[model samples]
Target: MSNPAISYAHITRVTDTLVTATEDALAAEEPLEIRLVHNGQQQSITVTMRSPGQDEELAAGFLFTEGIITRYPEIKTIHYNNNVATITLQPGITPALQPAQRNFLANASCGVCGKTDLDAIFAPVKKTITNIKVPAAILHDLPALLRGQQAVFDNTGGLHAAALFDTAGNLLHIREDIGRHNAVDKLIGAALKQELPFSQYGLLLSGRAGFELIQKAAVAGIPVIAAVGAPSSLAVKMAKEWNITLIGFLREGRFNIYHGQEKIAL
Candidate 1:
């Protein structure tokens, strides 16, 4: 049995003047068409290129985060075949497919943005917690902590990760995918399955913070988002609007705070 998320490829390695032919592991990328079945009618909702594992979670997470369906019960059954994930909705439950989602397509690098449908995305719970007070020490340690758990990334040096951590800095869970957005969806899906509280945990992204990723976090009600890479301008704005903390360039013993100091002590 081989890792479904990894594909083997032949490559040539060059160092200084030496050349060696070798076989290398690559992050797999394949199309996953998410279809919706409701009211006795089925339709392809969106297509995303993603790693091959966790297709079921990816489907549910995509629907929830995309604001197509609210709770997990809206889905009657989820089945995957030939790389197509079909989500059969519970009878009498209608999908809230946004205007753009009907024609959405996402590649492994950037998931099709949901900004256009922001006003219609699922409304997250409104709540408050003031005891988290994360310190600089905890923030600084997150990169190494998350990096250590990236099993496939250790082998392929590819794939993005999304992890959840308690404010005390304890790792909750993590998901990896060729697409960062997909990784987030997978994590959220797992949390949904496990009935974990999203607002109580912090989210970490392995790559730069993009608007769509922020949108996904907001939809899930995640309170803070930290990324090892830079954040887009719109991402910062969204964080501000949501009152969520946004940290970027979060490595090398340093991180920049872009919004929300309520949860950070220093």
Candidate 2:
């Protein structure tokens, strides 16, 4: 069976006066429209271009992380029309929650670019995570753990990844995508599907820790976020505001803690 999330391609390389053509594979991205229905009234909420598999989980995670719906019971059923690549969510029960201050429009390349406003970018959270500390040794070993589970990136080198790990440094879940934010969403979605409590876990990213990534982690009640790459200034600011532990440039047994250092056992 062919996987809709991946595609094969060919590429030509010329190096040192040698030209070679090789067969390769790449991740596929397609428009996925998420439609919401309440009391049988349908409303098209947002359209996102994402890797094709796990449509239902993606939608569930997106809604949950965006603060659109809190409990899984709020979502009745999710269906995808493969013909149009559109997903519809049936809210069987009336949603007592209001629409997000801003809607989301995501692409395969960037996740933070589609937001409508700053307030929406910095949505308020009700709970604050405290007194959770991870050993510095775990920070040093995280990249190796993340690298070992990246089966897709190992094969295609075309996808980013996000992983969740326990305090003991055991990898719980890892998700890959053409976009970094999508990867995080997939991980969050998987966690939500499993009904796992994420308050005690931390997030690890294969790429830079950006503002959107931090926001998503915070929404999911993930207390700590560690990235193998650098973080933007805004990402740091939001982490501080949200009381999230932000770590970046995590490599070579060293890392920088940008905020919420109380959670890091130095």
Candidate 3:
């Protein structure tokens, strides 16, 4: 048997008029409940459907991106059991479960599905990304580079991928999950664990760049984001406001720059 994130299953395939039974690899999706233990109290924060590997990173990234905790040191320990992640904060670090945090459902597809208000979902963070520029060639080549690194996507074609790359177009880290946001979270969480400075890197999203995705990248201090798909209006607006470069429709030879145009050398 493979890891929990992937499952081998028997499947029926139809080709023209012929039907055949075959075995296939599937990207597993399961419920992950995040819990916070603070001051001898336990609170189940939210439940999300995500691919199973890198559960710890998923838990930590979810907390950081939501402003639940700012730094890795704030966490005393993280433990997982049967889809539940228990996070114990360090002493003196009070857990403030805000209204927005309570409202988030952490759905696999979208990170902000059940939020009551736009402001609650993500209050803009002050601009921190600066002076990181990528050559047009490097920007154009990112999609193919990211495609080559999607190991799970190659098997199941059911997972989304996110990769962090430096200004020189070198891939730093990559993660794949059934959910788009989960993939980004895994990458961000890994970076946080390594304490990587995100200002000099760009994010490559395997799918459309949504507002939630942009928000996560901006929160990570990612200076640039390039996507193989389109960007939502709000994503562009947020990227522009945060001084993050937003690029979309990233094919082999071309891409569209919607914000921070100067970051992409023409």
Candidate 3 residue-wise lDDT, 107-198, digit = tens = 68978876776667883465874787798877777788888988888888899999999878899999999999989989998899889998
Clashing pairs in 3: none
List, residue by residue over 218-266, the lDDT tens digit for candidate 1: 8778888999999999889878888788999999988999998768878
Can you rank all candidates by TM-score, best first?
3, 1, 2
Better of 1 and 2 by TM-score: 1
Off by over 4 Å in 3: none
Candidates in order: C-alpha RMSD to true structure: 2.4, 2.5, 1.6
> Using alpha carbons, what is the TM-score of model 3?
0.95
**TM-score of each predicted structure versus truth:** 0.91, 0.90, 0.95
Q: Residue 87 error for model 1, in Å?
A: 0.8
lDDT (Cα, 0-100) at 25 in candidate 1: 95
Per-residue lDDT of candidate 2, residues 1-266 (tens digit): 77676788889978899999997877777788777777767776667778777778777787777777776666667777861323333535554234343366667876655567655555446555555679888789989988988877776778888999988888898888887878888889889978888888999999899888988888888999999999999999888888898999999888999988888888
lDDT of 2: 0.79
lDDT sort, best first:
3, 1, 2
Q: Which candidate leads in lDDT?
A: 3
Q: How far is candidate 3 from the true structure (C-alpha RMSD, Å)?
A: 1.6
Please list all clashing residue pairs in model 2, or write none if there are none.
none
